[model samples]
Target: MPILSYLVGKTRKLGLGATRSTTYYEPAHIAREFATLDHLSKGRAAWNIVTSMNDSEGRLFGKDKHLEHDLRYDRADEFVEVALKLWNSWDKDALKLDRESGVLADPGLIRSVQHQGEWFKVEGPLNIPRTPQGRPVLIQAGSSGRGRRFGARWAEAIFTIHPHLVAMRAFRDDVRTQVEQQGRDADSCKVLTAVMPFIGGSEAEARAKRDRHNALARPELGLVTLASQLNVDLSPFALSATLAEVAESPLIHAAAAEKLLMQGPETTLEQLGRIFASSVRVPQLVGTGAQVADQLAELFEQGGCDGFVISPAYLPGSFTEFVESVIPHLQRKGLFRTAYEGSTLREHLGLADLPG
Candidate 1:
């Protein structure tokens, strides 16, 4: 938070991720902190609401076990409710800076949140004044059914992972349906899928580069990461065994696991390990600048996604290549912006300003 005050001055938007834990925080704390950050950023703050998938994270929070996936989302639903109430406690014109009359605020313009819910008991108006954007943008990423419902209710933006264009389109359409069902504009929520791009001089070069990256991957790290993400002990399974054998693991997210297995029914643990060790099952876009741009545009135009969250395989190398190569092609095709369209992230994302 101390750093955020200064950070808001440096960047146009900042997203803070949070998880549900018994010992760490409450709705009121999150409400106040993000509200303060929104004020500091002049409406540039975003809250990336997350349910911690790493089972070991519970240990750090003094819990014997992680909360069940569905239950976690249930709690998050209420948590967001309290935060929204606190954020909306004050009107935009609540603050009237009149020096001559020594009047700083209109008392009638602000009110207590007075929220009492299943997951939280937040009392009154936040200590901080209303922010420029009114409140921080809400982001949620949950591919599971319960997770999707929670996101549909409140999330302004959603982060997703789908390895196939067909699946991506389906997910996007489903989310918009969910949004409309909630009495909100379908366009209000933007869906961004994760993409790992391998940009090179040509298609063959990109493939060769990807193969080299795959060769350097460590399967042991993949096992640990998969265990944490799925909340299951995959060590007991043989590396040669098919994913179908372990698909029913109670700890796993059934929907996500099925999707992975469908990619290759005979997919061995080692094969899956190699695929995941390098990338967490996101679709890999491997090609030269124009070819990659064509693929991205196709997906975007087909309603596969609103945008993408590019997860580079290597830091400066991968990002540098994309910016110098792919970005220009996308801009030339009129599929991407060549310059900053707005000052605030909300404006850039085409989100409506918060209600005053």
Candidate 2:
């Protein structure tokens, strides 16, 4: 799969972190920087559209609090719409370099996005022309109902985490339905689950490592985050109590807690505690490279996903290992890229180039 990396920072306000930001990175700068990167990567880069939701971040901008998830997505929707217009404002031939008369661009091919949306009104004729792919691929990480709807309408890739097979399959199906409901081909968008690995030479070692990491997680922060994510009050439940009863709570009901219990009967209240705190029952694929990759393959084969979003405990070097070890195995099985086959992200996604 073609990779999408951030140039500056994240809009951590949505649900993952804070609330929302009033101001920060301008569209023009991000468009230009990302365009140049796409040019360099030869059209294998994507844009992760985000708007910060940190209430503290809002306060940084002299606000009392952050906006809700719905409002944040609304603003980000307008922001990305404007960004797309800025990208398309220049036709591929606008830079018709003619050394004969010293002409560089055709005036007719250049245009502006006189965008006036509910949250953002941007008057822009982007500084940089079009990026290599006509548009930088759009990816969304939100998984809440409203977030899923927003992403299905606009996102080419939906970044999410789900632990239970039942929940993931149901969500994948529902999101696809939403895409169709929005007049888009459900298959046009792809689902990528974040697989945070805790690799070791053996299953026992890997399990130990996973336990260590889980233990390190902050409970208070996790509960706060979980409460916000599930739109439920988590304060009522005691950490020591098994979620056996919190099952009735909308936050935990029909969700992955039950599934996790089914998967690992020995899983303790503390483990369930973490899931509640994190507010996501993403099956943390903790195992050796082979075991992890095999699980990923199983998920892909079952149509639970098109691929994995390997979120390593380590950063750059960790991904390098993933690409070298797991990626090669996946490729040998005809599951991943051996070389660049397309010149653009859309092409990588099997999408047609946009009209002039």
Candidate 3:
């Protein structure tokens, strides 16, 4: 969050987002922090809401175990509710800088958010006035059924992961349906799938580069990451055994395990570990600049996603390559913006106004 806040001063038009877990922090703290960020960034701030995944994280929070999935979502729903109330506590016109009368603001314009919910109780007319974008943009990245429903209710943008076009389209369609079910315009929430692009002068070069990167992955590290994400112990499983063999493990998170199994039930633990370690399961897009752009265009045009969350394999280099090579192609094709069209992140995303 500090880094993102710092970047707000260094860059313009880049939305500064920070992930805050609903399972741990106080709703008022999250509200005040993001509200301050929005004001500091001139409304270019976003909060990536998460109901943290790791059980170890629970230990840090003085819990014996992580909250059950659906229960966690329930808490998150209330967390967001409390935050919204706090953010709306002060009206947009609450501040009246009338120098002549020596009045700084109108007390009548501000009201306490007397919220007492299932998970949080906050009395707030937040210390800060109403933010520039009304409230910081809300973002979420939960692919489970409950997670999707929670997101549909609040997320302005959703980050997702799907290995194929079919899966991507299905996820988007399902989320949009749920959004409409929540009485929101389907377009109100943007779905962005994760994609790791390996761009080169040609497709073959890109493929080779990707293969080389994959080869360098340490399977053991991936097994640990996969274990953490699934909330199961992978150490007991033989690396040579196929994921299907352990799909029925009682300790595993069924939904997350099932998603991994989708890669191929026949895929060995070693291979799966390598894949997860390398890309964390985000789909790879390997090709020349134009070819990669073509793939992204296809996904967007085919109802797969509203956009992508580019997961670069390496640091500044990978990001630099995408900006120098792929972005130009997207811009030339009229698929991406060449310049800033709006000052605030909400305007840039073409998001609808917050519901009263």
* Cα-based TM-score, every candidate: 0.91, 0.76, 0.96
Best prediction by TM-score: 3
The C-alpha local distance difference test score for the whole of candidate 3 amounts to: 0.90
Give the Å shift of residue 209 in candidate 3.
1.0
Q: Model 3 segments beyond 4 Å from truth?
A: 248-263
Between candidates 1 and 3, name the one with more favorable lDDT. Answer: 3
| lDDT, candidate 1, at 272 | 78
Estimate, for each residue in 153-185, the C-alpha lDDT of model 1 and write its tens digit: 988889998988999999999999999999999
Quote the lDDT for 67 in model 1: 82
Alpha carbon lDDT of each predicted model = 0.81, 0.66, 0.90
> What local lDDT score does residue 190 receive in model 2, on the 0 to 100 scale?
85
Cα lDDT tens digits, model 3, 109-223, are 8987788777777788888898998888999999878899999999999999899999999999999999999999999999999999999998999999999999999999999
Q: Give the candidate order by descending lDDT.
A: 3, 1, 2
Give the clashing residue pairs of candidate 1, or none: none
lDDT of 1 at 231: 67
Task: Indicate the worst ten consecutive residues by lDDT in candidate 2.
Answer: 11-20
Worst 10 residues of 1 by lDDT: 14-23
Error of 1 at 94 (Å): 1.1
